[model samples]
Target chain A: MKLRESVIDKSIVQNFLVDAVRKFSPYCPGDLSMATPLIRTGIVDSLTIMEVTKYIESCINTSLPVAKINRESFRTLEALSDMLFDFIKEHNLDLDIDGLKGMG
Target chain B: MDNLGQVLERSINLYPDDVALICSGEQVTYAQLGERVAQFASYFSGLGLNKGDSVAIASFKSIDVVSVMQAALRVDLVYVSLDPRFPPERLKELIRDAAVSVVVLDEFLSQEWSKLEFLPDCIQYALTLHDEKKLEIKSDVKCHNFKEINSDSNDYKRFVPQRKGEDLAYLLYTSGSTGKPKGVRITHDNALAFVEWAASEFEFSQDEHFLNHAQLSFDLSVLDLYNAFLAGARVTLLPEDDAMFFSYVVNLIRDDQITNLYMVPSGIIGLMDKGALMKEAMPKLKRILFAGEKFPVTRLKALLDWVEPNQEVYNLYGPIETNVCTFSKIKTDIVFRSECPIGEAISNAQVALRQDNGIISYDGEGEIVVSGRCVSPGYLNSPILNKSKFFLQDNHRWYCTGDYGYFDKNKVLWLKGRKDNLIKIRGYRIELDEIESHVQDTELVDDVVAVFHGSNSESGAIVLWCVFNQQALDSYGSIDIVVNLIRQKLKSVLPHFMLPKLIKSVKELPKTNRGKVDRLKLKERGI
Candidate 1:
């Protein structure tokens, strides 16, 4: 069931983020484009950020590096997706995008 | 010693070598802090800023930020803090509303307000700090690097200005039901009266260390910062980035040897539940203070059980206008009701139930009013509001808190919720009427009703029900898009916490017999 790092693209990670953000942050705009600012627009607050990060930890089955949580990594959907993609690549996960998405 | 500046001077003379501030693991001594305060005081004095002029800064806790606040006090300028997380337009509006002459802005928050677009004519100076970037302010306002003010120092004449007790110390803005935020003005006498009482009552001293959990704009920070300074105690400034991270906050408390913790119940609730309170043990923390909202009983009991026998817990109560008029130190063995009493009034304050213009005694439940040294001067530029919110009775001014509460036979006060549409979420006050009014200003909707969803404020989110004017769904194609557009419109006017969680488009909002929107009905009939 292991998937190579190359199999996961930036778009897939972005889509995952969009879905995660929508689930936790109800006020988020429906049309979340790649350049949409997450924290600046008040769409994703500290509480929502916590939910999103916890979701990522659960999906990865490991603790996300607590120190890696910074403002730049969450500037926009594109940036957040890149961070997730990099996390997957760095970890060399045994699952692909769908596996990351889980059964929900 | 006429003011808080004298208090700082006294502390410096008493313990020059003692650490006064701890931020990012760097320690600042009392003498060093005294020099920073004097440097800024001399600079501000050199400028033509009136003694009572306002200084606006971002509400981030840091060594320099605290120093600037002290310097303002030293020169008798009123201090104010604007949360940088708020939208640029809103921040600009606050600056204009308060008539701020000087602003200390963080360079990293450029995205939020780098280009305030148009500077209000009242602004005379802006200090760009927190980073190396010389962030450009595209305005006629004189901009300077905050760091350079220290380096470009001239002969610093150290002197504390003489100020009457009634001179304004700071202005804290809270959500107003009248569709705009109102500034609560605190004078030195108003603040010092409370600080002196609380520091002595709570026993804050040189050995104790308090954590700056509340935002600088919040009144809670007054309790932490002022008390520490008055007692020659140390304060650990929590960085904005690590604020919500419970693990990090708990770790900081343990690592920094923080002895005192004061925060809203919501923050403490999160820290207790998610932060793993027992791990990286904080034995140095001796006193825990909670305020702003009610703490759930079960979680509170668990927290009380977890702490050591020496650690004391207290529930402090007050609105922004009255800084902690009442507090209850919880006794672990006392059996509980569904709610705990808010305790008796602090020294220099009198608490009672009031009806009409008269004060009522222990039995009757009416609007909670406090008359004493802790009362704010009044709202800024709000004569009509000042007339209604504050009143002279029995030759003493009393601030009407608008909260309905009664005292039991034990002389303990219990809260009975607010009489207005104001609500608190994570200690940030939101006026539901303000949201509805702003949404109506857009004119895209025929009517908008804002209601809280969920059982209580601790777990609830704001929901807006709107009836579009015409062709709204057709133009937007979907309800989601319509809601998004409305939210996008609202971001510029309101703070992030005040934004509605969900927006629903309905043909007509339900109304009561009086022809007013039935908010209770809307809250009951959830989407």
Candidate 2:
């Protein structure tokens, strides 16, 4: 059976996000709960913002326009996932795995 | 050396037609340059200018500016650069502090500021060419064409210096931390010490072509300009815009066969970003030296990987008070997350660590104090500061450099950070530098800054401000992942309270006039 829409396992997305953060920020680690304020607390300066935004756009298979990139979507992981999902769904995507998996 | 005039005469006798001064497209040979300076020196003397008097040279870094500076020196007068970019208030203050007797400015800036009356200290004001007609009525001060003065008296002679060493050559002011600027009375001996050291240390050949990028007001420019003169090497003074352009720099190096490059980290990074070396910009480039700020390890590593292994990269460190005091040469292969060691002190200089209690030691982290011929006499007119900071200890005067660092067992000096940058947050004292260290350590993060802010209710408690890496976010889009990474890293080294309550990533860190990270502006903008 084809994996139904909304049947996504978030574990894959979460783990990939962690690895990506670790690779980009070698000085900092990749745990999500602890790094919630990466944007809010002033950890991600402008140079890192552009770099991370480009990376996120490529992974989600969508062009993240500069205008859409704001504090709301960049504030947290949950917000970013929702933004990415909506961005994908607007194009009439078939599935939204528990917010992860199968992309790589 | 008292032999400056003699050397000039010798150079004129030998390389009469060799290119000496090149401003824009205009070129003047050694003989012409020598003649021009002597003529100008005599012209100033004919006007009754005395030794020890201050003459303000307010112009861009052109050949004329260099000629005027040398003329002032030859006539035994101190040459002060009236930087056009300096704030009016600072300029006025410097005019008063230095007791400047004459002011020389170019045409463009003179029109905008010709009417503003300087303080009573400045007695004469003259405009360089093109502004001669702008001033409707001139004061009692004598004004003459800088160019005409040189061409008029080819046979003019100057009364060369009878006294040499302790006589004040020029007053280079510190960047002014405590509201009032402090002038460092750099003697002839002090300037010559660094010039002689660099000329010998670099093995400056007669064939080497040099580039002068820094402003004359900056002490670093002294090394660039004088080192060239010391070696009798040809120097090309780069425009500010051209120095900032990677393509232009590459072209200049390749076409001019520029053999030596002494610049700040920004210039180096710009060239790297433009892939200047990827196209083989300068096949003849041999030396690369960067100073003023810590060179980013990531950018430096990539630059080293791209450039020739034989091309030397020297990390030169020193405060304005000491002229290029310490140097650490890095091998192309060495990679460091933190700042490279300031290296061992240069020849004839001694760097020692002084703790709060004032014990000089070699090992422990403390204030990096320098005691040697390189030390400035102290601030002019500020006796209190001179008494406190610049003190005679063990029969020698030492300038207490506020920077904090320690010497390794191998005798290499590693700077930790600034001592004055400590902040108290919620009863926990934290060095703002510690946050910077963490930021630099993070690979995903290109730039990070931690600023101390106070809550609306509390007056002194600290609020944390941060900016993260943009490149990482584009690839990962995981804010939680980055925060978690930083939190985990800090959890082991920093206490729980030290963790920033708010994490906000921005596009860039604000920089001040000196290209240093500005926290005050960040606080004003908020997260």
Candidate 3:
């Protein structure tokens, strides 16, 4: 079923964000958590960030702010989730709830 | 200076205290670099690797990896660079094809160690670049840490090794349409042809600090590494993992005071799109070079505006088979409407367009052929391909570039389109069949056709249309789920850039009248 971007639970969105990094990252030195450094450790680059962004946009059925694709938003899983949640709250766009469940 | 070994030794003698390499804010002087290269060369000789033997270097970008490359050249050993980002299976295939004797791997690749089972049976040893580490592998290949040589006290006095110019220097593997990687064999003379011409033509001196934006595996790095030593100049190494980050790239260029920058156009395009690159940001960047893929004219125009009047932009063009045979200094008044001119052939080479009916024309539209010291002998271990792609005509052997282009009245080259499905995404050469071959290996699909969408710009993407087999049909619930599952599976097996941007389920892919998968039609249908 369809859902408003704001209707999604915060923790669920965070889980999705974490899941995206874990699924796409080539190197996860440790069990990746919300605090794992994505940019500083050189685990994710700009291109990998784009893949993670695309996967999130694929699940949400919407494109993200071009600004959100920067290194700051991708600093960590926590940072990415925080940025996506705030952007979702601001936009309040439509999302395919099932699509979120289907992806990593 | 008949060989690169002489280039290194001469550079060390002439510029002992000058900076040779820089990475991560650490500068390595030519003397220090010479000592490391000599140590590696002596250690490799101790390992019994003869002059003609081929060693494979598989590592992430680092100063040590560059050292190993120079050492291999010092001892007159042929070396091939293996991208650590490639799938382990693909790595094995390349190793087996090249008959790689030993693999110099990065610590990142050795994290889980050889448990990935990527090393082929032919590899006699695996050299991991870490101080102290353990590798877990079931194979008989001996594993050792690189520090074993670096930390040892056995001092072997460095000496120059005189090697023949016709001997093999390195093997570069490119995506072959035949569903396998083809190794292009380059010799010392072939490499010197480009380096000597480039160093003098570009006026590289001890003062020029170069930036290596491409991986060592890519031929684009040839200019980055060789030209520096030839000119007794300094070159900065950019780590492969950090090549995509805007801040890392800009900070390195600004702080390092990089003067000569060589990279694919898409890299700068991405930075410019984010509004990060300013004319004043890199004041020391004097020579801006782009190669590997076409730089869209619109972005090229923007780049011209972004760089100061003193800074020069150049378009360096060549396939891997011919290492940069032609180059053009870009200007505000460009002749081509949508693309930059490839310029006339360099001083060391000649370029001719050959028609299908055995006619070689210097001006008209046809497959571009390069002949001279710049032309590689042929693909290693592929005699059939060597015969077909390279030919002896008019007392010169020419390597036919699969690209169809023409020479204008000014004798400048303009790219029309590819005569094959080979595509370059962000300057990485990829074959449509390469992705399809891997997808077929998954055994989940009855058929698959991969098509490239968009220009070679940042917007470029690969899309795959797959027909599920009976096994997949019974195992999967929906097309969406199946597509997602395939993507996750492919992620572990294909290089990141080669991964399909999208996948779709199909009962059957549409075909053209020739009963071949209609790539053009499918590409148009892709997002």
DockQ of each model against the real complex? Answer: 0.33, 0.03, 0.20
For residues B1-527, could you state the per-residue lDDT of candidate 3 as single tens digits? 67766666778888989999987667788888887887777768777876778889978777778888888887778889988767676778888999888888777667645566545778887788863765556688887776764544223245456675888889999887777888999988999899888977888878988988888999989989888887889988887655766656776678778898888888887667643676766989888899989888877887887777788889999999988988999876666566788888999999999998978999889998999998999998999999999999999999989888998887888888888888998788988887788778778899998888886647667888899877776778666666766776666556667777677777888899999888888777766
Ranking 1 against 3 by TM-score, winner = 1
| Residue B386 in model 1: lDDT | 95
Clashes of each: 0, 58, 0
DockQ of 2: 0.03
lDDT of 1 by residue, B1-527 (tens): 34755666777888888889888777798888888777777778777888899999874667888888888888889988878777677777788889999888775564345645787889898777676766577788887776666544422245657775889888998888888899999888888888888877888878889999888888888878888887889888886656767767877788778899999888887777666676346878888999987887887888888777788899999999998999898988856677777889999798878876475555668899889988988999899999988888777788889898987778788888888888888888888999999888877799998888875555689999999877777877787777667888887688878888778878898999999888888888886
lDDT of 1 at B497: 85
Error of 1 at B272 (Å): 1.6
Tell me how far the alpha carbon of residue B444 in candidate 2 is from the true structure, in angstroms, after superposition: 41
Compare candidates 1 and 3 on lDDT and give the better one: 1
Better of 1 and 2 by lDDT: 1
* Alpha-carbon TM-score of each model against the true structure: 0.92, 0.67, 0.87
Candidate 2 retains true contacts at a fraction of 0.00
Residue B63 local lDDT, model 3: 79
Per-candidate iRMS values, in order, are 3.1, 14.5, 5.6
